[model samples]
Each structure stands twice: as structure tokens, then as C-alpha cells.
Target: MEKLEERFERLERLAEYFIEEMADFKKWVVRFLSEYKREVDRQIREYKEETNKRIEEYRRENNKRWGELANKLGTIVEDIIYPAFRPVIRKYFGCEPEKTFMRLEYINREKGIYEEFDAVAVCQDKAFLLEAKSTPREKHIEEFKEKAKRFLQYFSEFGDKKLILIMASLSFKEDFVKQLSKTNIYAMAYREWEYMDILNFEEVKGA
Candidate 1:
């Protein structure tokens, strides 16, 4: 009986040892899993940040390429348009410009902003803000109107001069010309004869 009791006690101790080992194993697994989860989350966050940075870099590069291309194309158009524009204004308006300027860039030092006119022609009691475009769209018309409205703000001295917004283009959409006829703005085309043909000549004369 005594030997049997001793064997039972020994068995109990073995059982307790296994229970303690199982508890320790469970703790180790929990700790390892927690650390692994943390690592995975950290890696995911870093990967997202890197991906965002790369996307931003790609966007900036694309914008830069587009800007350079636009500048080059604009220069070519300006070369053809600037010289012919003044003559058109003279032929139709029946007067020569007192001052003709291209790309009239002005910076308001106080406002820290700048504005540019494609071409500005000032005749007596009249000023024409002419924008030469490879293709003229409706948005160009709206832009010219907005620019003309703000013209007085930039050049307060020209407040007395009538602002005539004109768009000189190589070609115009049919509907665009119709739309221009309805507005105060004028549209002109460079003809095959290399002379300016005012599309809204009659309408302007009537106005």
C-alpha cells in the first residue's frame, strides 16, 4: 500500500510538470505570434509609404515632361503669329497701334502674382488683347473675357480704353465662330493669302 501511494505521488508530480510545460509553451506561442504580427504590420506600413512616394515621383516627372513639351510647342506658334497679328488689327480697326507688345508679362510685387498677355495692341481709345492659338476652343473665349475683365485691375491707366478681346487662330471650329459672333470677342484666321481675315468683322463694325 505504501509503495502504491508513493507511485501515485510520482504520477501527480509528472502530470503537474506537463501542465506547467504546456502553460509555458502557450505563453511562448502567444508572445511569438504577437511579435510576428507587429512585424508584419510595420512592414506593410513601410511598403505603403514607399509605394506612395514612388507614385508621387512618377507624377512629378510626368508633369515636368508635359510642361517642357508645352513650352516648346508654344514658342513655335508664337513665332508665326506675333508678326501677322498687328497687321490684322490695323486692317480691320483702320488704325495703327500706338504700342505693340508680345508676351507682355507683368508682376505685381505687392500681390506676389504675375499675369501675361499673348499680345497687347493699344490704339487711340482702344486696346486689343489678342491671343494667338493653333486651335481656338470655347474655353479660350471664356479665358479672354476673364482676362479682359481683370485688365483694368492690372493696368489702371487703361481704364478709359475699351478692352477688345480677340483670338487669332490658324483654324476655328464652325460652332466656335458662331459662338464668338454672339459675344463681344472677335475671332480672326490667318488666310492662305497670308492676310488676317476677321470672322466677326461685320459684327464688330455694327457694335
Candidate 2:
């Protein structure tokens, strides 16, 4: 009877030891799983950030390529400048265009004269002539003025309409805008690189 009791007590101690060992194993498993989950989440976050950055870079590169193609084809005027005409004319002149012409050309064999207009919008009693440049310069302003002087000669039908000249580009410098304000011509460009607008409307109109 004494031997049986001692064996029973030994079995209890062994059982207690096994229970404590199991608890420690469970805790280790939980800690390892938690660390593993955190590592996975961190990896996912880094992957997302890298993917977004690459997508943005690709978008900018694609836009630059398209812009270069447009410039090479001399379609920058049609692409960038033509769309701004109606809104600008209507807003500043308070009249919608009856007809709009793009890339208009005139050749007078008798006078040996040739002229090309980037855009033209004819309203009730007013006409807007637009000249666009990918890269604008001071010489371009003077050249446009000379072209404006001969506009009536080319299109005698528009002679009765009040002529309004406009010069357009992607953007303009402050000095360029100031110089344009001194002239009768209106300047149209991107405002804050967001949308196209007339830059010197009030100054030109008040002049």
C-alpha cells in the first residue's frame, strides 16, 4: 500500500510538469505568430508604397512622351490652344462665337501674300484671332502684332468686325504678362498649371 501511494504521487508531479510545459509552448507559439503577422503587414505596406510611386512616375513619363509627339507634329496649337478659344472669348467679350475656324490659311496670288491663322472665332460683330507658340518669346509678340495688322487685308469679309488679337502658350512669366498688358492683344495661358484662362483680360480690356 505504501509503494502504490508513492507511485501515485510521482505520477501527479509528472502530470503537473507536463501541464506547465504545455503552457510555455502555447505562449511561445502566440508570440511567434504575432511577430510573423507584423512582418507580413509591414511588407505589404512597403509594396503598396513602391507600387504607387512607380505608377506616378510612369504616368508622368507617358505624358511627357505624348507632349513631345504633339510638338513634333506642330499640333500643340490645336491640342492646347484651340480648346481654350470659345470659353475665353465668351467670358471676356460677353458673346458666343457664331463660327470657329482652326488652322485657317489664306493665299492671295495677285498680291503674292500667304497667311496662316492658328485659330479664329467670329461672333456677331467681333472676331478673335489667336496665335499659339510652344515656346513664346518677345519676338513672337512683335511678329503676332505684324500679322494682326495684315489680318484685315487677307480676310476682307471680317473687316467690318471688331478684331481682337490673342496670344497663347502653355504658361507665361510675370514679365511677359506685364509686357502683354501694354499691348491691345490678350494673353491666354494656364492658370496655376491647372486650366486655361485669359491672363491679361482685365488689363487688356481696360487698355
Candidate 3:
């Protein structure tokens, strides 16, 4: 009932319609994929930014805690260690200090001299100069020796008395105590980790 050439023409029209529909479908799929990729990239960028902000805040908090701890340790020399000086001096030196001074500063503008002493104790015939450190090291020992050399220049009244230098800390290594014994300076620290006493008093007295 249908002619062969007419049937062929009808099939060609259907083929053309399918081709146009396929092209539109492909364009829509590409657009959807591109939009999805952009959304994913934006989410990833926001996540990274939030993570970095949290990390920076945590770091700042950690630093604040460490700073507070350091301040507490610094005050130990002034508050805890210096207060124990009187008893230690009386026990070791066999006499109580007549005059006690803490955090004393002496400056002679005319002579261009400036000095600061952590603690000083004066007796009838002896003057004790105390230097306290939270953590004592070899450099601190050397620095205290230098300070002792200039003590009489600042306090001329103490020049007539026998000057005794004391280096004090919360604790000292056994080897460091031995090293201190060889020096003229007396090392004061906790004995048996309980009470404060001079570690090298006898050795220093004999020297």
C-alpha cells in the first residue's frame, strides 16, 4: 500500500529528529556536570579556610599557656628562694644577719657605675651576697663570679667586711655541686630534695 521511495523518506525524517534530540541531551548533560564540579570545588575551599582558622586559634591558646608558666617560674627567685636566705645564712655562717636587703640597686652617676643585687645579708665581720636562679647553669656561675667582683665597688660599706658570695637554686646537679665545691662561692640548694641548705659550705670555708 506504501511506495518504496516514500517509505525511505519517512525513515530519513525520523533519523534526523532523533539526531537533533540527542545533540540537545548531550548539551544538557555537559552543563549539569560543570555546575556540579563548581559546587564541589567551592565546598572544598570553604572547608580548608575553616580548618586553617581553627589551627591558628589553637596555636595562640597554646602559646598563652606557656607564657603563663614561664612567668610563674620567674617569680620563684623573688618569692620562694629569697625568703629562705636568712635561715640558710644563719645556719651556715654561725650568726644572724644584722641588716638584710633584697632587690637592692646602686647607681653612682658621677663614677658611671650601676649594679643590682638580688639579696644581701650583713653580719658583724661578714657580708653575704646571694644570687638566685630558677635553673642554674655554668654561665650563671660565671656571671655570679663577675658580679661578686664588683660588689664592693657598689657597696663601699661592705668593703671592710669579708665578702661571701652565695649561688642558690631550687636544685643542682651532683656534678654541678662538685664543681661549685672547687670555687670560692657557696652553692645553696635543696638537700635530699626536701630542705634548703648550702651544698658546698665546708669546701668553700676551707678554700
User: Mind giving the per-residue lDDT tens digits that candidate 2 earns over 101-169?
Assistant: 998899989989778999999999999999988778998888998898788787899999999999888
The lDDT of each candidate is: 0.82, 0.89, 0.87
- lDDT for each residue of candidate 3 in 1-207, tens digit (9 for 90 to 100): 999999999999999999999999999899999999999999999999999999999899989988987898777767777788999888888989999998889888998977888899999999999888877888888888889878887678889999998888888898888777777888888888888889888788898
- Sort by TM-score, top down from the best: 3, 2, 1
Candidate 2, pairs of clashing residues: none
Model 3: lDDT of residue 39: 93
Stretches of candidate 2 exceeding 4 Å from the true structure: 1-73
- Badly placed stretches (over 4 Å) of model 1 are 1-72, 192-194
Using lDDT as the measure, what is the rank order of every candidate, best first? 2, 3, 1
Question: Candidate 3, overall lDDT?
Answer: 0.87
Q: Give the TM-score of candidate 2.
A: 0.65
Error of 2 at 53 (Å): 29
Highest-TM-score candidate: 3
Per-model TM values vs. the true structure: 0.61, 0.65, 0.70
CA shift at 128, candidate 2, in angstroms? 0.4
Model 1: per-residue Cα lDDT at residue 107:
93
